[model samples]
Target: MTHSSDLLPPPGDESAGALRVQNLDLNLLKTFNAVYAEKHVGRAALRLGITQPSVSHALGRLRLLFHDALFVRTGGGVEPTPRAQRLAASIDRSLAILQAVLDEGAQFSPATSRRTFRLYMSDFAESAFLPTLLRELDGRAPGVVIETLHIEENQFNVAIESGRIDFAMGNFPHAFSHFHHCELLQERYVLMMPRRVAERYALDDHFVLDSTVPPALQFIAVSSHPQSTALLEQHGLASRVRVAVPNFMVVPAILYRCDYALILPRTVARAFAPLGEMAAFEIANASTWPVNAYWHRRFDADPGHRWLRALLIELFRIGTREPHESWLAIPPNLRPSALNP
Candidate 1:
């Protein structure tokens, strides 16, 4: 929808001509983009480092200019109208292009520049990787900020394309040829049990499914990823699964408090092992999956994005040895590193 009045003369002048492109303020469009991204005035203001009143003022101008209520207040937050959604694609692309052009010659210095990098990752990755990465950033890039968002598998590609998420880290089956990716690590499934259970059962480096253990031990199944459950079923351990949880983060506590054992990724199990209550054991047969860092190809040459990519690669580079501390009492060879170089 076009703005009703392109050119504004004196106030209350019905003869005012149409507005021209030259008269538009790019800052207002930028504000609109922020609001569109966050869908809340307060959050958008925080994102843009502006005041809520300013954001509200910008939205008002946008509504008047477009002759449409671009957004409406909702119980949870602001919801974009259909017109806003239609305008968003072009507006976002235009702003991105303008941003790219402006950043063409600008050098990115992480140490001094206050740049916020957003990433989409699962809780497993957060538990495994954030400590080391944050430590590195504290020393090398004091002014840089890092924000992690939960990965919604269905919208992963769209989030990256829209610049809502700078990087996505996980094992995704679909190939995004239009995006750039670097393998961060490869992981296989492992059975994690409380230290007491491991010691009581005399389970060493690997757990062997047997008549003595299969029926007696309770299995904790994660509903988010069924691959692990499927593996258990293939191994005829499906009947043992008594506790089903929606997320892997809850597995550690569940196993610690109960006699249940969890089937999880090796890296995730290792991350939980250091809590001093859990121990990881190799599964009888499990397939490995690669965890990768994905980003839009449009940012391949961006200085800031390039720096961020390098930082992630450096911190998560495939290593010959998994971090020794992830395993509680497991032997060195049995302990898999989170990343493989």
Candidate 2:
């Protein structure tokens, strides 16, 4: 990587003043950051809401200012030069700081703000959370937009760090470190099955591979969360799984069609319960986990982010704390006023 000192222009040279960053336009830096992230001018332009020619023009100006090619054309897309790699981190951080400073001087009113926040969620969480969230937003922050994205678990850190997503909300079984999160609610898995299938099992006993369960109890495993599917394999019932789905959207249809039970969150099962075609039974002593809303520490003070978070807490976190659940223990130093006040 090119060292930072290598970027310095010759001292006392009259022509070298233009190379200084303070003289650089913020738009050039924004374009550079977007290009560095996307590695393609077309994609960078799309991300920045500008035309491809405009992005190229900004890159040309940035190259003259930095005196480095910064990005080299490749067969697929451009790859950052060593100089660009060294500068990218600092530039991104500087941009974030400037944005925060501007936000501090500005106020965000939910009733009027038109900010679009990207939230990460699975189809399961979306089905359970989005309707209620959108309903509340219609009454409170009608102009604020919520765009939900399906991001893999491994990409959560990168998504939040790059400002691609505003929040990660779900039933996360483990904590993702170096972030702040508050428990939205506690959820346990339940056996959601055809009413006839549910009638075959006894709800009072713990869920076992072989109880007084039906002789034809086939399983419809939802593959979105491993724990739900893993519970079946752990009990040596993998061979009994008749089919697998990627999400909960089709579970209700499958339950009505066959003598199958799906292991899914109680919150989702609760929604299906009112449908009357199926029955949801709690698995006694089954694994339980907390649903949480996570955000980066860097965005802890932004007004719109805070307002949306406050609204989420109001909607999901009801009643007293459950005893001895470590994941429910939100950090004491978080923005308490937005959450509790």
Go through the candidates in order and give each one's C-alpha lDDT.
0.76, 0.73
How far off is model 2, as Cα RMSD?
Answer: 18.2
TM-score against truth, every candidate: 0.63, 0.59
Give the per-residue lDDT of model 2 (tens digit) for 1-341. Answer: 65423454465656555466568899999999999999999999999999999998888777768777898889999999899999999999999999988876566888977889999976666766777788778989899899988777787778878889898887554445888888877767766676566556644323343344565678888877788877777655678899988878877777767778777776676555443455655554577777788888899878788888898887777523532211222233321221121
Poorest 10 consecutive residues by lDDT, candidate 2 = 332-341
lDDT of 1 by residue, 122-164 (tens): 7677777777777778889999998998755788878899999
Model 1 residue runs over 4 Å out of place are 1-104, 209-214, 319-341
Q: lDDT: which candidate is best?
A: 1
Error of 1 at 6 (Å): 46
* Candidate 1 positional error at 104, Å: 7.6
Candidate 2, residue 325: the lDDT equals: 15
lDDT (Cα) of model 1: 0.76
Query: Between which residue pairs do clashes occur in model 2?
Result: none
